[model samples]
Target: MPEVVFPLDSTRSFTDQSLVGHNRWHPDIPAQVHVRPGDSFRVHAREWFDGAIRNDDSADDIRDAPLNSVHVLSGPIAVEGARPGDLLIVDILDVGPIPQEDSGPLAGQGWGYTGIFATQNGGGFLTEQFPDAYKVVWDFSGQVATSRHVPHVSFPGLVHPGLMGTAPSADLLSRWNAREGALIATDPDRVPPLALPPQPDSAILGTLSGSEFDRVAAEAARTAPPRENGGNQDIKNLSKGTRVFYPVFVDGANLSLGDLHFSQGDGEITFCGAIEMGGFIDLHVDLIRGGMDTYGVAENAIFMPGTTDPRFEQWLAFSGTSVTLDGEQRYLDSHLSYQRACLHAIDYLTTFGWTPEQAYMILGAAPIEGRLSGVVDIPNSCATVYLPTSIFDVDIRPSAAGPVRIDPGQGVPRSSF
Candidate 1:
């Protein structure tokens, strides 16, 4: 098919009657454009927080962005010849930060920002330890990310698109909201389990073709965590050359994406991530008839490059067990135990004179990886955090930090974002 280009112009209007500024992703949102199978496309997306931020901007600038408008995604590009039960293959080609024309000395190409969420908002992997909001502007030249706000450490870049997904059918959207709402109701502290709950987007509502399907779609769809529709699954392995398989639900598989990152480690410990920036993306999209049937799963699956790229370095690993060093079961849930492990890694890094904020930025900005070492252990499970040794010039290892503490209550509460 032909190559489609979704321009970066923030002022261009769509046939759907929505202005260019209407960039949020929701099933109710109408498709701005369409492409045929085997078609290649280029799209321009804004940073997760949009362009309100600058290199010199502070934590306040980070906090000022509304949670509802978290990821300013580009298009719900409808793919022709794609239908329900089919698989949409998105081949990532290239990703880079866009140059800023009005930028100051520190702003422009190779420059992007990272942020920690505010405690009052109550979200993130390390919410309790790094309660206060923080911001760090990183320089991405020389293929390494270095931040003055977070000094004494730098790492190479691994550019990737943080969000990629297809639009859900109206029925699927309702089920998602209902299931998520029920999960939130079960939390005693009411910590939000869902990444995003449905919120009204007047921009999307205005663009609906006034069809009954569009109205229902509007009330149920949300862009947050990864779902069958495939939204924000911050998997670091999905760099250039990666093949992403998204299950199709809607007629055209309305694929939309945004939330670009210069580099990001696993877990995205903080709510925000590495060097968020606006950039253009090139993708080759194709359809596989009955591929979903052969896979036997109705979700997103990623196929990694056959060979590890030279950019990835050897990792120094840190391990944490669900049971204490003394062997007492702390949490029955393996996922919770794994979280404690990550926190342990964070605390240990603080011994190197890095504040929690700095450490948080390090974990997010660098290509530090997280994995569950094992989950089969009945009472005690284990998790490991691996940091690429090449990221630092010095021999950075965990030293005698104070005894690490795990707080089960320290997590994001359930709320609409």
Candidate 2:
């Protein structure tokens, strides 16, 4: 075991931890832990919700989830001697569900959850089709996850961190706030809002209080979306053995991480997609000393993905063009095309006795592949989603025999707006 630099007790609230971490991104949030280059350490991360989500059947928690306090990250662990313009190299040595103990109230205690947010709250990619909140609980045995809500399916967990990044400098943070705030101002009343802005409510900056805490809280950036600083990229490919280079903006290269997922597909189609978990990650950190400028790595993280991801040779694919469900055509929109492809998959799955919600959960939690198949095809771009046929208990391939129906047990728990 690496040195337990930041230990967490699963039973306690995230704020009650010995060395507290922040929920928002700000350089001023003091680093509670420090390490030198070439250090191998262990970090215990709370689930993004800090245990606000549960392991039960009800979707009430998902419907009324606290949107303000989120992505409760584990650090601003200052790397000694790390300076601006340096590239911070982080090697994800290992990651998985909560260590040792299993079977508890939390999400990652031998189980985890995948959720679809109601459109009124945190809407997802296909929120138009799924306006209600839904929840699916999956049990972990070894490395595979099996959900009782959507039965007759099981797949290997592609455990990884969904949020990891360094603290943003004051100038960089200002730019983030300016752009995101402007976007929000455009649609301030939009349900689920265009983008989350800095709110003093539920802002948890480590140790700071009084007027200083209020000042930083009002200016800090939310951890909802990925930015130039690599806040919440949610890339499932960043598993063990992956080496990531993050451009250092602040002194000490204050890096923080959390929102661990046992498995997630590309895009994480559902809002609370992925098998959300509280877990421990083994990391080895080193500095690249002026490598940011040397390599022309200006922004965002560049990572060499690990080679040990789950392998699948055969896939049942679905493709969709850039057209709305209501028959309106959009030009060269890959995001819209991918949404269509996912909807096509969900419709196809319903023929095999799975609900649209069940199918959506599978696409979010499984190791499904989503790709841009065509972008240069004039007015319409084409996107594709591929599902590993082996993950299902029955042969999902198209045949003269037609789709085989799998019993969807109990169905997904739902809560409507």
- How much RMSD separates candidate 2 from the native structure? 0.8
Would you estimate the TM-scores of all the predictions?
Answer: 0.84, 0.99
User: Runs in model 2 with CA error above 4 Å?
Assistant: none
Top-scoring candidate (lDDT): 2
Which regions in candidate 1 have their CA more than 4 angstroms from the true location?
1-4, 10-26, 99-108, 187-195, 201-206, 209-218, 305-313, 323-328, 397-417
Over 213-270, each residue of candidate 1 has an lDDT whose tens digit, in order, gives 3554357555667777668888776777888888888888988888888888887777
* Residue 393, model 1, lDDT: 51
Model 2 Cα lDDT, one tens digit per residue, 1-417 = 999899999879999989899999998999989999999999999988888888778999999999899979898899999999999999999998889878898878899999999999988989888999999999999999999899999999899999999999999999999999999999899987899999889998988999999999999999999998888999999999999999999999999999999999999999899999999999999999998889998787899999879999899999999999899989999999999999999999999999989999999999999999999988999999999999999988889999998888899999986
Candidate 2: deviation at residue 256, Å?
0.2
lDDT of 1: 0.67
